[model samples]
Target: MRLPSTAHTSRPWRIHGIAPDFRVEDVWALPTPGGPDDLPHLVGQFTEGEEPGMAGSSFAYRTLFAVRRRLGRLLHLDDADGGVGGRVASLRDRLPADLLAAPRGPDSDALPFRSVYLLHDEWAAELANRTVHAVLHLGWVPDGAGGYRGQMAVLVKPNGLLGAAYLLGIKPFRYVVVYPGLLRSIGRRWQETAGRRK
Candidate 1:
């Protein structure tokens, strides 16, 4: 479910340190509730595209990704020349010594994102393009019952007026279509996978 910005900012997340300049675009409570050690398993599933909501399965979810890609191509939004190291700097460059030494699991092939860092309870990935530079963060939060649950937040540094406008335009679609499908799919996948592990 969508949450208030404070839900993300109130947490003492390391992401805040590196992305102070960016805005917390969105925060969500994922359905994948589990124990502490379950985070890596969740992250692994995400990286492998095992989550059904991400790629396809649902018409709405698939269509959203398709439209975004087409728009990106048409507008040259995700062009390499206008992406990280060109239009904007990479967030990885700002990592502290300890974070720099931390594990960077893997780069995302489907999403134009690069691994930033991976911690025991959190993982972050970054993407930069013409419209905005963004970070996708996944965190493990204790559930107060000797377990944990997944939390996700999106951080974005819009490039200029265009970036801001683009985000504004997509906000409704994200809320009504994109996010709902994503959460539902992830939840179903989590149940399927978790069942197997048990």
Candidate 2:
């Protein structure tokens, strides 16, 4: 479900250290519930598929994503010069000493992002293109029933005026289509892991 930005900003996330300039675009309470240690399971579910959070979701989500890709390709929005390490530097280059010592989880085969750091209850990954440089941060928080649930925060730095307009244009669809579809897939994948834990 959609959450107030404070849900993420109120927490002392490591992301604050690295990308303070980036705006918090979205914060969500993922439906995956489990013990504290289950965060790895949560992360695994998200990073599992060739197209994470697409399977079992409404076809609208896939179509939106496909359209995005087609547009990006035609406009050269995701070209080599527009991506991380090209248009802008990777967040990894800005990691603090302690975060550098922390585990940098494996890069996703499914997404155009690389791990930043992994803490006991938090994991962050970064992606960038001509439009924006962004971070996906997941945190495991107490769900108030003596269990934990995942929370996701999206942080972004728009490249320029074009990036700003780009973000504005997609906000409506992201809320109405993208996030809903993603949350559904997360719940489905998380449930599949439940039986194995039995």
Candidate 3:
């Protein structure tokens, strides 16, 4: 699904005060074997010793680039440009043809995948809480040593505030399994980063 433009003009969301009121069920991941790893480690590293959490924000941005590198390797996409935009273009080109050809559905059983980001406002909550958004990026990859790799990122913004992005990469697998726990772990890392902002 199309996401709110990542432009600076968008109103900043409020992250402080009340905890964000968002559901965990809405989060989803690409169906892949072995799912994502190092989630707790990532969160701990991000939250360790940081006062406000700016370190986590920096880590998220830097981590995205690292993920782009791994994605290039899995997809066999060249990263001569060595930038996020270039990496995404390469990934789009490498998606398995079958996934692109199949119709969209919850049970397509297809390996290739697409992603969506969900957003919710206080209208759905009791406290008139801050606007909350979740970024979900999903796609399929090979399995086993030879299988493809799938990767996705879930970013949350509270009260119109945007900070601390979270991402998870799935190893190659025949059947993809979306994990809610992993998403929550990622969201927490993002929150740590958001908390650090000045």
Candidate 4:
């Protein structure tokens, strides 16, 4: 479900230290609820965008994906030269020595993003194009009942007027059409994953 920006801002996430300038664009409480060990599965499912019960299942969600891709192509937004270490400097370059030395997670095959780093409770990946430099952050947070659930937050540094305009244009669609379906998919997958833990 869509959460208030405070849901991300209030957390003492390591992301805060790296991308302090990026705005917390969206935060959602994911459906996966398990212990700390379950995080790797969540990350695995997310990175594998073709997971049977995940996002890109519904027509609306797929349509949004198509539109986003088409828009990217038309605007030359996601070109090779527009990626990390190209148009914008990578956040990895800004990582603290410890983080730089830590094992970065597997690179995403579904998205044009590179894995930044992964820790026991958190995983972060980054993508940069013409419109913005974005970070997808996943955290395993306490559910207050002796279990952990996944939390996803998007942070972005919009490039310019075009970037700001693009974000504003997609706000309604993202909230109305995309996120609900995504959350439902995550919930279903989480249930399946949690059941298997028994």
RMSD of each: 1.7, 1.1, 20.3, 2.0
> Which parts of model 1 are misplaced by more than 4 Å?
50-52, 195-198
Ten consecutive residues with minimal summed lDDT in candidate 2? 44-53
Model 1 clash pairs? none
Query: Model 3 off-target regions past 4 Å?
Result: 1-31, 34-104, 107-129, 161-198
Writing each residue's lDDT as its tens digit, candidate 2 over 40-132 gives 777777676766768876888899999999999999999988888898888989999998998887677888888888888999999899899
Candidate 2 vs candidate 4: the lDDT winner is: 2
Better of 3 and 4 by TM-score: 4
TM-score of each: 0.93, 0.96, 0.21, 0.92
TM-score of 3: 0.21
Which model scores highest in lDDT? Answer: 2
Question: What is the TM-score of candidate 1?
Answer: 0.93
lDDT score for candidate 4 against the true structure: 0.83
lDDT of each: 0.84, 0.88, 0.30, 0.83
Report the candidate with higher lDDT, 3 versus 4.
Answer: 4
Residue 59 displacement (Å), model 3: 30
Deviation in Å, model 3, residue 4 alpha carbon: 22
lDDT string for model 3 (4-112, tens) is 2331113232211121333221223323333233232232322244321223344444454457558657754433343223322222233345434532222111111
